[model samples]
Target: MLQIDCPWCGPRDETEFSYGGEAHIVRPSDPDATSDEAWADYLFMRTNPRGRHAEQWCHAHGCRRWFNVVRDTVSYRIEAVYRIGGQGPGGSHDPA
Candidate 1:
């Protein structure tokens, strides 16, 4: 079982949280005006990077708060945990 360190609740069992998906996915400003293809892309597309990926995680069984986690996809090792609304260690917005 992997242990995830929650920014608000510290380290906890991975079972206590839910993977929200790749971070920094910006919602369309005018969804209704967007084309079908664009809408579908937003709904289904994601980057499958090999290293250092940023993602969102919700501490469902603990604090119920969401935060950003910088992890390695290849090794499944967490590099950093950060709170929402703040720039991650890499100096980028933790968007989702």
Candidate 2:
């Protein structure tokens, strides 16, 4: 199993956490003005990149807190872990 390093709880088994899909997905500023297609895209569209991808994870079985992780999609290797709203290796935190 993959080993995840939780920002608050430290290193733990992957089973102790829950994959929260891609991170930094900004919500539509005005849902009423957003078209149906745009709304659907906002709700479902994700960049399933092959290389290093930033994602969200929750330590469900531990602290139950959510955080961001920059991981390699091809190898499942975690590159970095940072708390939500905290700067990552990219030097900025785009809240999801």
Candidate 3:
């Protein structure tokens, strides 16, 4: 089982969280104007990085607020987790 470090709750089992996918993905300004490719990209595209990866996740069983987690996808090791506004171990980004 994967272990994740919750910034507010400390290390917890992965079952307590929900994967929110890639962290930095931004939606188009105008969804109506989005093309088929753009829509497809938004719906299906994802960055499956091998090493360090920034991803959005929800501490479902803890704080209801969403947060970012920087972890190694290969080893399933967590690097850090932080709230949306607070400074994390690395950097912060607007929540998706």
Task: Report the lDDT tens digits of candidate 3 across residue range 36-87.
Answer: 9998999899988889998889989998668888888888788877776556
Better of 2 and 3 by TM-score: 2
Error of 2 at 9 (Å): 0.9
Stronger candidate by lDDT (1 vs 3): 1
Candidate closest to the true structure, highest TM-score: 2
**Model 2 — TM-score against the truth?**
0.91
Can you rank all candidates by TM-score, best first? 2, 1, 3
**Model 1 TM-score on a 0 to 1 scale:** 0.88
Q: Is candidate 1 or candidate 2 better by lDDT?
A: 2
lDDT of 2 by residue, 1-96 (tens): 899999888899999999999988888999999999999999999998989999999999999999999999999999899988888886858754
lDDT, candidate 3, at 15: 93
lDDT (Cα) of model 1: 0.88
Provide the clash count, candidate 2: 0
lDDT of 1 by residue, 8-84 (tens): 77889999999999887888899999999999999999998999999999999998998888999989999888888
Task: Flag clash pairs in model 1.
Answer: none
> Where does the lowest 10-residue lDDT sum fall in candidate 3?
87-96
